[model samples]
Target chain A: MAHDAAAGAQPDPSSGGWSREVDLPSERGASRLVMEELLEQLGHHGWEPTDIFGIHLAVEEAIVNAIVHGNKLDPAKTVRVSCAVTPQMARIEITDAGVGFDPAAVPDCTRDERLEVPSGRGVMLMRSFMTTIAYNARGNSVLLEKQRAPHAG
Target chain B: MTAHRRIDTSKVGEVTVVRFIDKKILDEASIQELGAELFGLVEQLNRKSILLNFADVEFLSSAALGKLITLDRKVKTAKGRLKMSNIRPEILEVFQITKLNKVFDIRGDEAEAIAAFQ
Candidate 1:
């Protein structure tokens, strides 16, 4: 299917850099590709390998959350991803269509008892990798940013 | 997004071998289904030793890790063991990032993992 380049669409211009929008099915597997594209774009802008991995992980976690939980994996629905790269950082936004969820409602997975339970660590991992993460007004959209590491050659 | 993939299960003697033939596992439903499958295998075999082979898997997210952790806990409660083998380099990096490599009994191959139980 043709990628939906419209949902949560926005232009991201940073210090004369380029941005692109990707529309993907709200299913599994798509997130990995999306993350790869993000990495490629960031690399084109001179991001280092370590920063590339960090950005890829953060984007994957955010987009996966949107596709699985927000859009419920409905093929009919699409998760929108837009990436903006700047000399200072890379910012990405992913939006889904399902009823919004409160991030505060998610349990802390780092606790001793919950540590071994499978799942609910995506957001935590994103926070750990990215410099900042914020929920849009609707709560179905997430904005993630990772500051370019020092020596991003 | 949470990638979807299937887990193919087979038996080798008293051991239940759960093979992850997909490249990645990221979706919520798939994670839950995987968890259910592992639980069912443990109950059906009444065996605590499981060998999760990830030879085909290239990536794994925290959600996927969660499923493995859940299975680990279930097997431990049943007095069984959970061992993983043939993890790809990229996926192994994920396990290390989460420090799961330290907690999980990871081996180089299925024979070594299964032999550990014997």
Candidate 2:
């Protein structure tokens, strides 16, 4: 579509979808620009509002984790992000240029004692909002996917 | 009283009612500023009964949630109470998913939340 091209999203001939790639600085709020474009593409593809909200939240949490936790907000580091969106689904991959950490090591924030803790809930929220989230062996990169829910009669 | 850029505050009886200025509370800077302003209400002004009205907030991240948790802790430590109301369904789902619904007293509306305060 005209809008997709204007946003630098090229046709994904394989799936009749569109895709985009971006490299973001390891800085707070940098993800906003990327999310703005991606969200527009999701809307253009006719995604439901609820699904879009979940996808937006999941991707945002992932990007924040990459910048804050993985890259530690080092100016020297950059987060590489790629995304593909179709009428049926959306997929994203984010990679950070810093030492990665173990996802499993993150504590369960929902536990009784940990309920009041201020941090460590980002990873859990990402997992809950995204349909599937997979991390690389080094945990420096993550892939998030969400499928469009069928329309109600 | 510290001037607030991220929140608007008013008093309903003895309760300090706070509403967010931002519709989407996600960015780091805003979250940080929000945390400071909210903590100031209890730590500096010593306003005991606090109600965070989420009527304007459509979206918030875990970082925002962190600020709320810390504010709750501060209120409890000061022997004050904290409650939230007017959260949209999607945002409410976030609390339910994280089980934070159990951590904070969430009311159906601002009037209900303020009335529950003692």
Candidate 3:
């Protein structure tokens, strides 16, 4: 599925130093390519390797969640990714045009029984990598942030 | 992005080396395919020593990590070992975060990886 281009327009640059919008299809290949581009852009902004890795994981998890879980891989819908980077932090939001679900409903990956399962680790990994994570009103949008550590901290 | 490539397996004495030339493994479908190939290879080959060369891979996702773990378990069940080499720092950090570093046998290069199987 594809997002309505007009409705999924890029975020305003006034909100942050850098911003971009991408329409991600249900195909894993397309979704992964969008993530790679996002990482490259973030890296060019001087993000550290750790920060880059964190953002990468967060983005991938969010996008995957949106495409697979939120949109249910429906070709008629789209997963939208928006990213904003500032001196203080970088925030990435992924939204899907689908029915929302409760984040608490997700199974814990830390538990031994669920570890071997092929899914359900994305949200946990995203939370671990991000400084803060929150769901939008519709629950289809996830906002992930990574604060730049103070030079001395 | 580098061109997608399949795993190249060759025998180094009794040990088998699986080289991954692709620079990234992010997609679930591809990772699943790779996992299946790895499982098939491990089954077809009776050798117990396996080395996965990742010199070309610059980034790896949790899905890739999961597949590695799955393959590791499969190999272990067959009384074999799975080792990795030439992991990029970025990818290594992902493994370290998940505490997989302690679970997988990782070496710096082909020589060291092969030496471990001896």
Candidate 4:
């Protein structure tokens, strides 16, 4: 499914920085479509395929963590996704209503003992793919940024 | 060739090849469901060795990777080996970042992966 960024998107200044909010129910598969649409938006903004895939894949992990781990798949709790797509960079912020945790406490998936654990890799991925990943003091909100190469966004 | 739900499967000698039809696997429920499907197939078919071909898959999320780990663990418990093949570099980066490359036996081609079981 192709999501046209210019179709219903608001115009912004060339310098970058226009964002839209996506409220998703705490469902297991809800993150897929949102990430797909976000990728399409970034592509429209001149992001290259490799750049798009890199960021898109990371964002997918973030949204899934927010929905599954943070919200615990509760229907009442909502995962809020904030997106900013620009030619120079893309910034996505995801926040959940559930209580947050210490990011430092996550076990290393690379370790043999923790290799089979299911929840350890998402944050690692976000931190790896995004040039910068900032979390709120409460740890419930995460801001992920990826700078596009000079050739494209 | 046999189609098993969303995943397509085929037999090459004694090895079973499971190919994912979707390019991207980011859906959490779908990933969980995939784990179940793989486990059921392994048990039903009594297949000890398997090859997971990712040639058509372009992207994957952590949840999907976790499911793969789960599937691998089950195969190990059954005294079988699960090998992955044709992982794209971009997708492989995720495995490298998570350091899951150590946990998975990733091969360059399906033939190599299939031959490993024997």
Candidate 5:
């Protein structure tokens, strides 16, 4: 479950970046390993603390949504994650094996009536932290991209 | 005087001041445990006022936010008040982004939050 740069995770020397693709089981607490590895890669690439925080939050939300909401924590289901990180940007794609969902159906948690709802803020947080968040037609796969700040890069 | 593995709690006058033990509150199991402990304060002990201090917390995800929201509801149902303080700028942004800032009574520090309970 431990993913380090040396053990299968690829570091692109030519591009001065790191990229990794892995399949994580649909289980609670499965995203910790990937988040640690991704954060390490971001730090190695000189991402600022603020930027790292946002990236970490956004990525965590995406993976959790994939595992819990999309996959429904089915042991048979797996979440496929692809991450690419550089000083300039970080891009992550996560896909889960499930029925998927409609992003439009999610209520606006920020609205006055829904403000007190205990759930449904994951998508909003992902979109706010990452520069761009896109979901495929199936809505089971999400791509999160964070463009590094000018000063941080 | 409940034992908590994921958080630390203390008494501040009538308010139960709580602090997180983990820097990153991302995982599901821990967040669940945290929710249990927080809910215990209102549902079990019947504490009327609570203040959660987040000085040691560096990262928070939507799951953790869900727990906090649920805890807020529990406190309200018990006719109590829940407040949070000492959140770092980055984590504070998470609240602002979700607009939970409007849902919870967030203060600048432990002292301010405890005083607000008065």
Candidate 6:
């Protein structure tokens, strides 16, 4: 509980929206269940299925980048997720306990020959799904923001 | 073993149909599990031609996308074909964004994916 920095801050449960810091272990399996719970909460707030799916996938990518690529899947290292959601938008920030990276250094997997490569597309997928995205100066943290679709109620 | 349970396979004529038993492919362990199963399909089973159905899937991590690409190459090296079918609109959007829609033989139905083999 020592690292539960988000423990003190919680969204009003009645609002149907949520804001909190969730401690994510670097292990692979536990994170998916946590991701689902977050999306389910957003779904209750009237986010469209597509919107929920997009944000969910983008969120997973960010977490994976943190847990695996950033922290090298070290179980001792934990990933921290700060998430806020409303019917109109969702913002998520993932911070890893590892060194950062340069976005420009990632190669383009969309090129004709590179399409089969096993990596390098996670960041691109994040960029595509999120309305806006950024990384911290240390490169270990990524912020992903997605706006709710205008037509979605 | 849980990852093994996540994917189910069936056959439609000469084409092998691979579908995820889970609704989401966002878990890292599942990705590694699928990777191994797909490799076995290409190397050991000698069943390289595949049609992956995404009708049951709603969400998948970018890590899953990279694994799919790796499987695509494995099947190709085995001289087999891989086609995708029944992808939900949102999942399709992810492919379109990465332009991977251009890389694999994507079809709308099992019949079309099977027909592509002929």
Off by over 4 Å in 4: A1-8, A14-18, A151-153, B1-3
Taken in order, the candidates have interface RMSDs of: 2.9, 0.6, 2.4, 1.5, 0.8, 1.4
Which candidate's DockQ is highest? 2
Ranking by DockQ: 2, 5, 6, 4, 3, 1
Clashes of 6: 0
Tens-digit per-residue lDDT, A1-153, candidate 4 = 122312444557765646677777788777754666787788788877878888987787788788878999888788888788878879999999889978898877778888778667878888887889998999888999998767524
DockQ of each: 0.34, 0.90, 0.40, 0.73, 0.86, 0.75
Q: Residue A59's C-alpha lDDT in candidate 6?
A: 83
Top candidate on lDDT is 2
Q: Find the number of clashing residue pairs for candidate 2.
A: 0
- The sequence of per-residue lDDT tens digits that candidate 2 reaches over residues B1-118 is 5789999999999999999999999999999999999999999999999999999998999999999999999999999999999999999999998899999999999999988985
lDDT of 3 at B50: 88
For residues B1-73, what per-residue lDDT tens digits would candidate 1 score against the true structure? 1232476777788787878755656555676777776677666657666899998775567877877887788
Over A44-144, each residue of candidate 5 has an lDDT whose tens digit, in order, gives 99989988888888888888889888999898778988999988989999999998899989999999998888899988988888999999998899999
Indicate whether candidate 1 or candidate 6 has the larger lDDT.
6
Pairing residues by index, what is the TM-score of model 2? 0.95
TM-score of 5: 0.94
Clashes in model 4: which pairs? Answer: none
Model 1 chain A scores worst on lDDT over the 10 consecutive residues at A1-10
User: lDDT at A87 for candidate 6?
Assistant: 81
lDDT by residue (tens digit), candidate 3, B20-89: 7566677777788787777777776565888999987876777777778788888889988889998877
- Given the true complex, what DockQ would model 1 score? 0.34
